[model samples]
Target: MFLLKVFFLLLQVVTVAVYSRADIPPPPEPEPIEIIELPLPPVASAVEGSCTSGTGCILQHAGLVQGGSFLPDGNHVIARVNYTGAPAAPDPASVYTGDQIILVKADGSSFSNGSPFKCITCGVPQDSSQGKTEALDYPQAFRDGRRILAGTNIIDCGEFDLVSDECTPESTFIHPIRWNTAVDGSGEGGSIRELRLHPDNLHIGFNSFTYDAGKLNQYAYTGRLALNSAPTTGLPMAPRYDLTNVNVLSNNDTRNIPLIVDRDQIRINTDAITVGEFRGFSGSGKEATYIGYPRESSNIDVFAVDLATGDVRRLTSHPEYCDPIDISADDEWMAIMDTRGSNRQMFMAGMRNVPPLTDIISTTATSSTRNNGQRRFFQPYLLDHYGDRDDYYGQQVNAAGDGSPGSINDPQWNGMADPRFSLDVTRLVYWQALVVSPACGGENPLPCPNSTEPGGRTERLMVAHFTSRQPVPVTDIEPLSDTISWGTPYEPGTVPSRELFISGGVYTLYGTANGSAQVTIVENGDAIETVAVTYESYSDDGLTFLDGTENITVRNPTVTLNEVDWYSDLTQRGQTNATKKTSPDGFHLSIDVNTNIFNANGTLSTTVNGTLYTQPANGT
Candidate 1:
């Protein structure tokens, strides 16, 4: 589940910095929703206590998991964790005696000395902790329920047997068998990413990078795992495994040599099998999934290229960013992490199907915009088997409940890579981290929202349950807004709405509440009065009013004096109650407007509120 596929950008990302325009700042992130623990109902608490608190939750905390998956039993999870309790910790193989492959209860509960976990290696009596460097980034638990084909070798956690609700570890059960990691095992000595083990259990698919001919070339490859009679490599001890019959999917000149006809706008790159990075295999294991060369510039999506036929099918079509994908065993569902509702990429690719040819050159910029500093604006989405068909992006699993922190669907806790489905397809397992400083607060421009996930833990593994093993139906929904990009101080930005929203700030952020309405008078079949009004009405999260609504009533059907405009300024807590009286027929009108000043960014929210009193007959 690599977020940014091109690791070669390590150069540009280190040297250059990307910032949003100063004036039209990135919209403030929503306030932190409070974290509260809720006990599952007795009926739903049937899940095992080893993996959960026995709480059958839609989104349960599966411990402090990072890039891990459920084992063959569909009960416990396996991730390479460190003693420091931090991911990507300092030298995972060197820090705290190098991180060992440990399995913890999904609730992040640790026993004495981090016990109660099924310690497959390191501290177990059957394990050998001396001499060898222990490390793994992508750990794959084989279906055999014993061997783990993780980084560089196979971790034989002989039997994942648990006693007293714990994976009882034995030293004799664990040993490492080194393998020839890649066709060119030259990076960091050896490395592979976005690694996937095919269902056949004999072959594997992955992506790797190699510097060749003074250029850094990254390619996707598939190869068979074998125990060679001869020694594989001198780096690790002998009696090792090797990747035989290796096949490089995108290393050849399969892609067209781009011809820039008119600058970068009209460049020509053929739709060859240009696999950028290997994602994984489809559920059926017939087609291999990867992030292909951009079909539409700046819109990076998932594609399944047939391993046999070389035909390609686009799995996702959203203009916003998406990566970190997994297909269900039936290939009917796709669980992925994305930035659809965050408006994170709205600054770049949110213009929808109408992308500019010139924007083709900015694909890297567009892809990188999915992240900010150390934060990723990703949330889990459940796509149907059809991928993104017309307007149908997958369902946001967490978008359902009231998105309070620690709840199943808290939007503040951003999703992370590699969502895996249970073998039975009843559960989806993934991870997330709360957004904190630098990406939100601190010297960065965005407002500092607090973390409601208590005790200050940043990331956690989340598991979601489905009622049944059926694919969610798909439907198209045209979003309510468009944006104004590339604006500067000389001309500030503008936000326009479609038929769905009022002309306000919904485009700035999704899920923000607002309102719009049109009132008409049909007196004597003549066009007498028509009032069209648009408003901002998010609660305390709103941009305009805060607590309550404003009411106005007028009784004047005979008088006609309609040529006056009026306004009022409200304090932090106040309502405007004004009455206008007109002569001739004792015309009277009362307006009670309740407005909140502290709602959000604008003097209009604080400064002015417009109150009108008029009808078919007029008033002053």
Candidate 2:
């Protein structure tokens, strides 16, 4: 599916409407609970090679559903399952038990080369004492598929053994602890929870941290590796999620959180190892934060983290929101999904500080265009497909640097959002789930569903077309039942070149041989002049007057010369006239000249050299 559509869905979850009016009811509050840190479970063997290491995966019929996501490398993909909950479990012939995270290549190729993407049971090992229904619902088998960071759920808490690649019943997933348990002082207040991890997956995001779920706190606390002793003050929150954005720099004593906030007013929960905390995050993976109506105003802040000093230096501060920001394999250009206006257009910004040259590429599902008095503008807007299917709103709002559109006559974005250049970003070669509203496109916008039971829709890969510049339409036509997506361009420099002409002609070299004379000419030369010459010659064949008068400068003319040398011979052919010119002086004649002496030049000129022309022998 298209990358823009998937981003729209992610924004939806964060931008749930909360009316500020007193007459309106407050947003639903998260339930409260306890805070208990559990030790990671022991590793279990794969039943003596029962788990054959698969080479690849092939997906039959699956597509983007919701909570769309891509792999760390942006090459592999993980999407929400399209099929709803499986039939009541405990049946003798059930293919799956708990939630299964479907893994597939962006092209739907299988790990074993030819086989389709097969599902793996991630359910935790069931306890025999527990009923069969409960046995099938193991935590290990329930793959969240959405918030996968470093191959684990973002919410699963605690530090697991980084050595073995084995997962067990005790293996924690993303944010494994219930939200209520993360509260600090009993009853209801939220705690500054820290989700730390050994930095193995740096590509997904350098280090990420979000404020507590319920409240927008004044302080944003993060844990990082430091040389100083643990914090003596502030709320103490331990690592409660499996997927950590902070890197355990040098045994967790010195870690780094690459965050960029307007002010250093945020707090760091030094009690636990947290990487970094930024006010905004948007670019794919990196540090992304989208908070608004549908969370469309997300931004990714790039910064450097000092493991020892805990210093943060801002690397990128482009006001536009970019998703899946990536440096080219060469690291010259950085590719990102710039959600500057209504569309999640792909853009590339120069790392240098000279204003950052940027180019827009595609439009997100929620992108919009607008009209001013005499001019028109496009701001960040989304199709409101909430509640009723047809209730889609296409209002335009400026996603200004302050995270809000200021005015309709926003001249700062005159030609800024115009998609005139190709994006410099490249997507991973993996397929992920992409959600689309019916208001945007009816039925399947990318892949056509087969209407079959499980294998209904064709798997849609989320490829980043980093080089493409054209706006790929998200039309739900045939073949694509409902799932429709476009890949970023793989070939760069595909932008069509405008044609201009300089008056010119085709040039060719020519060589000519006449009797004992030969000449060569370069049909085209840089000289701007044309010259013509006439020459006389004698032939030993007694045909001296043959075509004696010919134009020297004819179009594509071929000039030849034949100089003859007659020898005194007394022999006769059919009774020779021996009496008249007997003993006539045997004259030696030769033509030594350069072919370039006579050349033609229209608007341009060419030269023909005759240094090779020779007349050695004529008669015996």
Candidate 3:
């Protein structure tokens, strides 16, 4: 029985081996593999190398556009443009080659002569009997929309009228004005760094230098003139032009009388409100305010001085350097640029109620108490906070010695400057330089040959829209939907659309939107409505995409009275008119007025009573 079982087991093993071999069959012949190639997509080419439509475009040869201000209607911009090369030396026979003041559309099209506006005094040599023509520097649009203000390298400060295409020189201080000269041969005074026209359009504030007792002194002075004043036709009087006699608001004299508010410290509100540096009281009312290192330390804090009373109170405090840029139309908030952190950034602070005069003049207060009190006046909140990604704005990492060939590539890195608010306070505009490259070439941390050198940067004019009635996180700040190199560098005083007063009406403005983006209008702390706006990638030849627009939904949209024709349909129909006015606090209130009607007898009748009431977003 054992022998028979062993034989059966051997047979079973042989059978299993045979079956496994059968299942393996012969290895199939290797099958041939197939490969396929796909065609590449077409490349889109730009029209004339110009970016006509898109989220952003680069204006390759637009020259250096500086000191830009949007027109009152936000349709155009006025700026100072310096052509690609340095100006020729001033010569009596040579043509004036100074910088040009120009008006351009939002689409980068020129409104004035596409060429440079002829400089009024460009060809006259410095010592010519005809008097030297000064070069135009900064150009700013007036609130009225018809005029612009610009500073000269000499005594010829003036305004250029858009309608007349002429520059009218204004009354300036009588001093030996010098341009581009070193202290040795140059006159005691220096060129005007800033020229600010008062809101009344009658007075001007400027930063300049004057020789006093063999020493040059810097001052912030005010020049006053009657309303509707124009510059005298010829050369200004010399040695000291006191025709418009300037009052020294702040000076660098030994007495430090009145304190020194540098040009950077002056902020002009829409209502002509001026806040600057003042030094009436010191530690326990002892020392002069403008006596420290950053040039005016003791009096460096911002102050709202009663120009009428000579009374002044501090608005901001120390550790962080604060320079006021602008004040809201309602005077409820102030925008500032401060160096509180590693870099300077834009900030906004609520305006605190002025303290009682009694508290300000108290003599027994300690320095600590005074500083603490001043600190309470403003609680600053950062506006452009980029955290670790601070480089969203350009970084100045490659200085001369940090691995670069020449200083030519030294980056024009900029921190946030020129914080501006719309007249309605619904938008804010500021500028920053963004870095495009860390190193110019791949595999080498050095500038590439013929390429935009390493650390290449571009200036961007950024806009933030306040869409929420309630205060939102700073991170939610809205940049203008489009991207373009929109502004100049280092100009903190130009506020685009700051004076644009759009009365209550509806109108359309262009913006870029994607399918995921929505247009929202918030009223009285609620998102009253939202419209889903879509964008289609458009190509003129089906290869390159262009910018397309979709309608944005707005509730009780506002338009400027300047934009409406009073004699048109509203008056002809004798329709009752009602519109909402937005307060600084974001509340909407209705203002109702009956239209002027032409009586059957042809006499014009005026509406006697207008009503004001709270209104919903739908105007119900």
Candidate 4:
């Protein structure tokens, strides 16, 4: 009789819809934001471009794939290159010898000019005066994947023959890792950024940036790395590497929450696991991925929490600009590094659910436009742990959006920061650079193209191979029999195609590669096995947790693993401005199930929340 009624707010009243520094929401009247079209994710690419060396088609090239990791015999990749053409000992101009730490042969196999790569920090005192300055930036491979932690150094140059993946830079040495920070000796020191190493290979998860009071703090730590028997009391002679039990994953604390409908109106949760920045962990380390805080306005997404259970999961939701990520080792899938299609933050996340106001104060001038300086408009998507809902946005590992200058999705060839996943998840290792000069060559009206790769070198090295093992989200009547898609974007992070579970009982809960839209698991009506979610509470008990601006998977999902997707912008009953071709018209999907705090050690979460309401008609 009312024709329409919809409201899914976590409280826009006293202001608790998220966007921090404290809270911001005040500018709305300007309007023009609406880019949304983003596509390319079903899977196709096989080898991809920009993998220079001699240009022989199958990986085995070197120099241009900085920062990579994925070696437990899934072929190979442990990069951090520099070498921009200068072999015969030529340009000792301290080009830093291009900051070596090589080895790339992502198993496409079949090449041999005598160098598939094997130069651990290349030429360091390892021999022949081949030293100019070894810089090694983001390497990671330990768990006997053959030693390495990079940038607190710790490398091992020989005897690493994973069946000739090769190694032996004449015995290199670059140890450095003594960061005390304060064990109580008055404290005075700091410096660390994105250095993760915790798959229990002995704890470690870093990221620090201090300045408190004057503001500018972005912490997220977890420590345990000791090798000191002596010598690090202040660096006697630089004995190196010592940090113990540090812990700080949610001590910035700030909860208040109380408005399920003006229960008096409170809402503060501030930032516990709702994290504003801290991106690493979760290969089963239990979950900690971060960068969330501006859920609507500035939009920058990517979240994942649940280190023992503070549970939150919002992993990337378009809005352009996603920060490098990885998560796949029997945990479903994810490989992020997005800028969507480089429409770059779409003015301020393309007006989706609106209400972020000036982001209060510009949110860093609107997330620094994703990149213009450090060059990173990013491009590398591959989701499915229930991330990116409704129309299903994922699958662009390098489909060659082809801006051409060097291919492989080359939008200027950006994309960097920890894009790894290999230990049988198939393969996906990354690196790319090439916008060049002061941000863009010469006179800078936006020139810089030139280097078409054969060592003309600006940065390259990417490997994407596929097979299939995570896609299953059916219902075209009963569609999902297998689903497994062949991998692409660029290729090689194998397990090529997947999408299983969900049939007789139904509990399926995901379906949108093209099948339209589906999200099941309703019980008495059908489908059931498990579904206990608590992701930062909205409370309804029994367990299903997800509402308001809802984030649909990018990674960090666990009720055991994946399935909490809910996009809900709801509003269409004769629509006003045609919200995405007539969104739900009056849709309220709460599907209740979840009961108070599950694990800070309390241990208890088993999900089944249900209560669906759909009224389609208007745009359809």
TM-score of 3: 0.37
> Where does candidate 1 clash, by residue pair?
62-106, 63-106, 63-108, 93-98, 125-171, 126-170, 126-171, 126-172, 127-171
Better of 1 and 4 by TM-score: 1
Task: Give me the runs in candidate 3 sitting further than 4 Å from their true place.
Answer: 1-65, 85-98, 104-135, 153-191, 211-216, 225-245, 250-301, 343-413, 434-457, 468-620
Our tally of clashes for model 1 stands at: 9
- Candidate ranking under TM-score, highest first, comes to 1, 3, 4, 2
What lDDT does model 3 reach? 0.27
Compute the lDDT of residue 307 as modeled in candidate 1: 69
Candidate 3 lDDT trough over 10 residues, lowest sum: 1-10
Q: What is the C-alpha lDDT profile of model 4 across 1-620, one tens digit per residue?
A: 00000011111112222334243223222112111111101111123322233312221233344657866676667776544433233433222344556555565453253545455565555332221223356778865666677766666544665334355444444555545554443232355556777666566676655432232335456666765544535542343456654554443122312111122222223232434456677676666676655555556677776555354667666767677688875556788888787665553355444333223222332344455555567877788665666456777867744456666765777777778877666667777767666556564556677766653556665766554433233212211111111101111111111111122221112211111112222222222222221122122222222222322211112221112222333221111121211133321111111211111111111111121212211111
Candidate 1 regions exceeding 4 Å error are 1-4, 7-65, 85-98, 104-116, 124-134, 159-190, 212-215, 228-233, 251-271, 353-361, 447-450, 470-620
Give the lowest summed-lDDT range of ten residues in model 4. 1-10
- As a TM-score, model 1 comes out at 0.59
Winning candidate number (TM-score): 1
Estimate TM-scores for all models: 0.59, 0.30, 0.37, 0.34
lDDT of 2 by residue, 1-620 (tens): 11011111111121112222353333222222111111111111223222122321212322232222333333234333322223333532133322344444444344453433333224434331111111111011112222243222232222432111233324533322212222132332122232222122222222212222221112122232221112222222332221112221212121211111123121111122222232222122122222111111112333322233333333333323332222222222332333344222111111111100000001111121111111122222311111101122222222223432212223222211111111122332222221212211344233322222123332232233333332332222111111101111111112111111111222211111112211111123321111111112212233221111111111111112112222211111211111101113332222211111111111111111211111111110
Name the lDDT of candidate 4.
Answer: 0.46
**Residue lDDT tens for model 1, 486-526:** 11111111111100101111111111233321111112222
